[model samples]
Target: MYHSSTFFDLLLLASATVILSLLIFLNYIRASRSKPSLPPGPRGYPFIGNVFDMPSCREWETFTEWGRRYGPITYINLAGEPFVILNSLDTTLNMLDAKSSIYSDRPTFPMLGETMGWDRGLVLSHYGERFRSFRRLLHRFMGTRAAVSQHHDVITRETHRFLVRLLASPGNLSSICGGAVVLDLVYGYKVKDHNDELVHIAEVASLEFSCAATPGAFLVDSLPFLRHFPEWFPGTGWKKLGREWRADTYKVVDTPFDYVQQRRVGFTAIEEGMSEHDADILKWAAVSIYFGEWRGSDTMVSSTSTFILAMTLYPDVMKKAQAELDAVVGSHKLPTFENSDRLPYLHALLKEVLRWAPVTPFGGHHRLMQDDIQDGHLIPEGTAVIVNMWGLLHDENIYSRPMVFDPERMHLADASLFMYIAMILAVFDITKAVDDCGRIIETKAEFTSGLVSHPAPFRCSIKPRSLEAVSLIREANLMEG
Candidate 1:
């Protein structure tokens, strides 16, 4: 009963449907083949990829474990964000160093870097012209031949001052010495005392920024939509914190430069006839390292603090280091940079300290610029590359009993390992704390989680290595005066 035209139309419709289905089936097959390209990781939930799996604290441990289970180059997804963890040093260097051009960009944080006006920060800056400029200026001052001869006096002066400070306060004594050195280096602003208000200002700003950088710390960072909410709106504390941090960090960026200008006595980039842009580049360049944008904690302070903690935990290592110093520099004078060449054990001790507990557990987040395959896994462009320095240093295959602290591992390596080796070893005799009843207090090899993994505040009895050491510190300080 159907018309011929209608019958043909129905047949044509059926054929079209069949062809469309076939095309879709073919596409599905292709997608299935490529779906496994993403690296293997803990099977995450469908909607939230490993959100709960990402640890809020001590993530380095879990990351290393993942590396062991999966491979050196492990992958994990955090709420749709792509992350590639490089737990092996070889893989880290292969990508981040050997192929650095494509892997060196930093992960951008909207709340911390953008809203906070930290685009100027060296660590968070986009990999572009500005960053390159900052690096060049920094290299000339820090990584060049002039850096040594110029800063040697300041370092020795600070180390001696550090020894004297230990004679007074045993709690977090590294602050005065470390802060003094950085202040002198960057702004040429000599910190006459530990109570310098500028140091406190920088400390507060850096700490706030660090806490903000923690993953999953702020919902606003993940959900930019929340940023439109009112300032007084409930749960918008992150917005307020971000604003406050921005102001503080900007001041951190600007205030010191201003001080250098006012004093006109220090080595600041704010020279006559230079444009505002150039001066700003120099100012932020100093901020980049001086404040260390990642954790905002000064490198000198954190390392020095951990050195003291390490000494307290391993008295035998401290004794051996002290002996090396005594043999080289003698008790008549505190150790000098010249004595560094003769102090091999002290150099090894610094290497072990850095390895035992890295200040930057996961070195700053580096974003990939192009898609690349590593060990058969695809590292898509823009993937957040986390070089887990902690994992690399703690690899059991590389270091025997990686958890234990031992300086002897590098005794045969070389003397020129790091700068502060002989300086710290010659200064303090950090030991176990005791109560009035002469009972030893408990200490843990624990670390606090942040952009930097500083050891948690622990009780340690800090003292000078010898009475002669104390006398030397006083004599050096007076000579400088």
Candidate 2:
């Protein structure tokens, strides 16, 4: 009888286990059926899921093509992660702007943020109290046009110096001007004409950032668990690299910060007395201001470079701008912010530069905090959202002949870009370079592919429009000195 009872008990327990498993399976099926389907995208394989389909470079062009096929909002699964690409400006604004509460969060970058120590900076910082503190400090410093105008002297001086450098060595134009302006603005440290230490440090940090931040460049970014491996372990070479990059990252933040503390010069929001945490926030905020303007192609450097490239390619646009600049500011004096309102064509030209090569082809990724539905499709929580800024700017519906550089189509303006482009155009004439045979070297609108796109290096001649222009640049430089 005891043996019979044991057998019955075993059978009952087995039955209960089977019943529980069946119920759980039924619930899962029901939930799966109830859940909304994701938006249309290229079909993916079983386990990898669109990993191979993702473009290693020039992703914006691929995303744009997906937009053509799958509509404005295209969804794809990478492994288990959901990614939503917004190809239209309206959709990007609706999701990232209108629903910013959930869409403002930045995706975690294990390689760049955690290992390389970039999360301390504003660009890769997660959306939270700390991020808000950074924003608040920056806003207090230069939130408005009036606030920015307070530094007009710095801008005007650096810009004149840029003109001098361009006149001397046009080949080094890419590396010269932007760093000087930013370093002066941030630390009051005047960049040496060549081989500036601070500029080199920052440049190294920025290059590391680009490499580590590139998707799939480091295996640890995908398999974050790999970061736990010992440095001595095989295939752990990246750990050593990470250590070096982290050191550079901190150096870039601390070097100028220490300089500011020692001399008490330069613009700093950190006050005399504050809590340790508060002071740290202010420090990073100052560093952010430096990197925020200087690091990305979408900022002053790339925009100015694009302006130069545009002017070289489109002579008509350049002539129209110079005509406007001549009438408003004249050849005797370099254009100033005060003269901005008078030059409509130049304003339009600045806008065209931004639209033509959009420094950031893809806006930084925004992570979804909660599951949401839009246009009858589901965007799951933790989805990485990307806006194809290039596609939006080039959308055929929005601008006629979007590929062509036309200032007439633009109505908006960028202040820093306006200052740079207007000052340069007023003094210098940019044209295609001639070969040794005296034939004009034909160039196309080719640009580099990365987070920040810049016009590929092409031969272009940058010279003063007249001897008066050269005199004006020198006089302004001397006056600032």
User: How much does each candidate deviate from the true structure in C-alpha RMSD?
Assistant: 3.0, 3.6
Which residue pairs clash within candidate 2?
Answer: none
Give candidate 2 regions above 4 Å deviation. 1-34, 230-236, 293-298
TM-score of each: 0.90, 0.91
For each predicted model, how many residue pairs clash, with residues at least 3 apart or on different chains?
Answer: 0, 0
Q: Candidate 1 on 13-69: residue-level lDDT in tens?
A: 999999999999999999888754877788887756776777778888888899989
lDDT per model vs. reference: 0.75, 0.81
lDDT of 2 by residue, 117-233 (tens): 888878777899998998887886678778778878777787888888888887665654576766787677888777889878987887787667655577665555667888887
The runs of at least 3 residues in candidate 1 whose Cα sits more than 4 Å from the true structure, single-residue gaps closed, are 1-24, 31-36, 171-175, 228-235, 293-297, 411-424
